[model samples]
Target: MKSEFYCWLANKLPRGLAYWCAIRVMSHAACANPAQEVDTLTPAQCLKAWPK
Candidate 1:
């Protein structure tokens, strides 16, 4: 339901503007949920943690 509304709204927007809006929304959500555990890792980090 929410995704449907988002898709409809995004389609109504210009392509680039829709992408920018999505990025901004995601950034805001990440900031708002600082305490959330995010195990995001760089390629180097991932390799270092990989099992032998």
Candidate 2:
């Protein structure tokens, strides 16, 4: 759900901005404690699980 939104948002953004946004988002997600089941994921895991 969130990943979908992120991807959509990233697609709409400029390439450099999208990369920066993704890195920032992933960094925050990596540091934060899991709230939902999906939130428990590591950055690598999240990337893998993200829709391609």
Candidate 3:
């Protein structure tokens, strides 16, 4: 496959961020989608959610 798009994109992005995005794009297939948003609790959110 040609990498003209990737080169153009990578040049526009800042440094190592391009590689980070590239790895995720290359590793995953079209059908296999990773969970982008997760529900988790932080100390502040926990306190706000269940305040005493």
Candidate 4:
């Protein structure tokens, strides 16, 4: 999902801004995906949802 989001952003944004935007957008998107259950997520969930 993170890969898909970056692929989507890379296609939409300029190179200079693509990475930053992708990171921010992916974070927001991950937190919003219903399957992920944002409300029940713990810090560990956060790490898993969008790990480095």
How many residue pairs clash per model? Answer: 0, 0, 0, 0
Clashes of 3: 0
What local lDDT does model 1 show for residue 28? 52
lDDT of each: 0.58, 0.66, 0.47, 0.64
Clashing pairs for model 3 are: none
lDDT for 11 in candidate 1 is 80
What tens digits encode model 2's per-residue C-alpha lDDT throughout 1-52? 9999977876788888878867766655554535635456666765654446
Q: Model 4: per-residue lDDT, tens digit, 1-52?
A: 9999967867987777866755565576566566775455565555555645
Model 4 residue 31 CA deviation in Å: 1.1
Across 1-52, the per-residue lDDT of candidate 1 in tens digits comes to: 9999977887899989878865555555455456643344333443343445
> How well does candidate 4 match the true structure in TM-score terms?
0.33
Which ranges in model 3 have alpha carbons more than 4 Å from their true place? Answer: 1-9, 30-52
- The TM-scores, one per candidate, come to 0.47, 0.41, 0.33, 0.33
Error of 4 at 51 (Å): 23
Question: Model 1 TM-score?
Answer: 0.47
Clashing pairs in 2: none
CA deviation > 4 Å runs, candidate 1 = 1-9, 37-52
Point out the worst 10-residue segment of candidate 3 by lDDT: 29-38
The digit string of per-residue lDDT tens for model 3 on 1-52 reads 3689867866899878877764444444221323322233333433343324
Error of 2 at 36 (Å): 14
Scored by lDDT, the top model is 2
Question: On a 0 to 100 scale, what is the lDDT of residue 22 in model 2?
Answer: 71
